[model samples]
Target: MSPSHRYEIEGCEVIWAIKDDSIGNTFFDRGAAEFFLPHLTAGKCEENKPLKRLKYTVTESSSDSPKKGDTAMGGALGPDWKDGWRMKGKHDQAAHRVQVEYQCEVQEVLTREEFTRTGQTAECFPGTSRAEEQNDDWPVYVLLTNKRLYGCDFVVSATGVVPSTGPFLHNDQFSVAPDGGLRVDDHMHTSVPDVYAAGDVCTASWEPAPQWFQMRLWSQARQMGSYAAKCMVADRDGEDIDMDFCFELFAHVTKFFNYKIVLLGRYNAQGLGKDYELLLRCTKGLEYVKVVLQAGRMQGAVLIGDTDLEETFENLIVNGMDLSPYGEDLLDPNIDIEDYFD
Candidate 1:
């Protein structure tokens, strides 16, 4: 029987089906956060690039020398951030306890009736917490997918975004990026003369800095619009304009889940690929600081909570200084990073 009220749910098991696209890796690791998040992501990426709107990195490295490090330790700071980020415990329980997932695609979401009609009975419980207390007394619906069924109750949709290019999709007179953002030059000029576009509707067609790339974000949109105006003014007077310094390296400051977030450069080691390494340090409650290093140069970072390191990190990224010499001391949570760099 289909569910009616809370009491009416006793006989029928209602389950939200989430199909995981990660193959042969086991089903539990698929879309674990999306399955739990109350809000789904609403962002688009460049075509073939396929960027995710949000991702989490864990800080699990304390290597005194060098190693492939985790990127999440930069966010755990809690109370002592203003006082030079003086965090207490170095390792809070365990550093790598969090299971961070990304690029998890939900192939489909099927209703209970559809699941039954299709006759999928894959009993995969990767989504179930290992700490789950057995509640066999509570009858639940039979859950299954092309991947496997999850122990957690609730439906998950993995469609992050499809760009709304609108009427511009069919116009051949102007160039378009694969994501349908109007192709814009460094000066924010469209292919057609006298035409200008910026913000979410535009994409960068020029070569970008090593640690810089475009993403659909509030800060970027504001920066783009402002720069486009300047470029327009410069063009009207026939004056040449240099690309804004803001495009030199990525810098984003905002709040997420009540914590102040500062992302600089390739915060998540985006395009660095296998050659990059991460340095992470954190206290459980206070802050998380993650630094990305490629061949000993600062490439990017993710800073969470209130540990004040944005200015120093931003300069380091812009300067492209080699930091392989510092090793572990680079991310010491107790040190005055700004003072040292100064």
Candidate 2:
């Protein structure tokens, strides 16, 4: 069954927009409400007025599409994600269509007084007041607003990706690109010398996704930080660094109303599935099983509804075990494989 569109934010359970309902989604940071632009603008104009707003519309579709009247606007630049322009849409005969308009740069930070008082800018945008909008250099306090502050060397353009979603990498040395993203060389140490970054801040290729990828999950950020630290420490010790671990071993499980969804590895990884064998079964509700193989060994897998099997599944994928030895007997409901997992 197709999963329903549902998510809990700040304890609010939100569902997709239905027919004759004017319900809309919101995009917000700790500061300003970014996704509420349409509503805000709509409030400022007549109901039938064409929206003269600055926003992004998807340029094309790569695979999936959103539901009717559903509009997903955000950058996909986090761990296990890519950095690029994304377009999401849905079709609903009853609700008004979510129209994508123009491209815009969303500034979510502090105000003028707060910026000048301290050299740091807040994490939110509007940044500071109009009075403090003149300063161009970092270490210079340009108040993005009254509540938040930041210490930035430069502001780079992250135009291709979504705005306000913390998908940029966090680096020790900060530099800005002309397009609004940051540039840094120290975070993770690599087999290649002096090339590293962390968080949703960098344009480095070593990231989970390519440049312009939007990343915001805290776990992804922490992992990036840890990996970068490991690299830096390894370099300081003159160690023969191994870069293999940088590859992501993804696992995620979540509920959509009544149904559960689980994903493993980088199932989205291009061409990875070409050589892999797949098995699927439908029992209680919907259960999906995918096994990846390379040279007759298990490379990775995905399991829905049985996260308890994560370790066993991960072991098989990572070690490239000869799953052929067990065959379909492994799926026998009675088999307890946990004992064999290390």
Candidate 3:
């Protein structure tokens, strides 16, 4: 998940420790593994050949699980891709190319670990039972369910994040959200005056816009930090400032599994109930575009692959333009939607 492995840090050695052998799990926003695996393989080279060129396997429990990126993943990519010319497309292509070109084996591992006696030594490993010591660098391990045994360099647990609330919550000075996050007002101010919280640590306390909700994403963290700073300055001058417009609607753009992912507003049809309608156009191995509409206006959208429709869809969601007349043709690949909207 980090590119720092490419450089040598003086007086520092970084080891990525995780409980699981494979990367990315339910704890991660979907498609995170796809976005990150390439970098990980790219960092490891053998005989001047990048590891990405080697055959590898990506194992998952469920067949449908690999397709999690088909829907909105509830996370945002870094904003650096926002304005760069063709940067978004190129990044998407790279991710997809890695996915298609790489030799990935996907299968389910039913039992992660089980205990059984082997006619071996009593050396202990984290997950498995005692086994006989072998003349290997690391301890020998067995999978009872799969009837397999292997040796490895080390175990790294890549489990997801858990909120650290010991310092703030245990003190009883601040209010906590149901999800164990510190609750903050629209100004990003906590229970105490002149004390504010931003980023993943704080839960949004203000009344959210109809189309907007909070996600512990990097983009939102940056937005909250900036908004909190503005709020602090305004308080010093006794001036008032409205909440930043970024919170009015949700817009996220990122790449996953080599596909361009753009999500806007309630991309997953969140809170829309049964009244909303969905229009979809999908080309196998090419693109998947889905639009959410309430009445006649765009409420949200998910555009995957190089559709190049983010700007138009974003405007449509914001302007509340009625597309009922165009109906299904709104997503027609043959149409020049940009010019039509312009």
How does model 1 score by TM-score?
A: 0.59
lDDT, residue 305, candidate 3: 76
Candidate 1: tens digits of C-alpha lDDT, residues 68-118: 654535432222222232212233221111121333434545555555566
lDDT of 3 by residue, 1-342 (tens): 322221111211123333343443322223333444544423222222232222324444455555655533333334332223331221222221111112222122222232223343322333334453222444324222223333433333323345466687657789889877888998888997688998888889889987788877776787888899999999999999999999989877654443557788888778899898888877765777888899998998878778888888888888998889999999888999988897
**Comparison by lDDT, 2 against 3, better one:** 3
lDDT (C-alpha, whole model) for all candidates: 0.60, 0.41, 0.60
Ordered from best to worst lDDT, the candidate numbers read: 3, 1, 2
The TM-score values for the models, in the order shown, are 0.59, 0.41, 0.60
Task: Give the runs in model 1 whose Cα sits over 4 Å from its true position.
Answer: 1-158
User: In candidate 2, what are the lDDT values of residues 33-144, reduced to their tens digit?
Assistant: 1222233212111123333423344654454765676654564323212113221223222222222212222234334555655545343223245464343443533222
Candidate 3: C-alpha RMSD to true structure equals 14.7
Ranking by TM-score: 3, 1, 2
Candidate 3 deviant stretches above 4 angstroms? 1-158
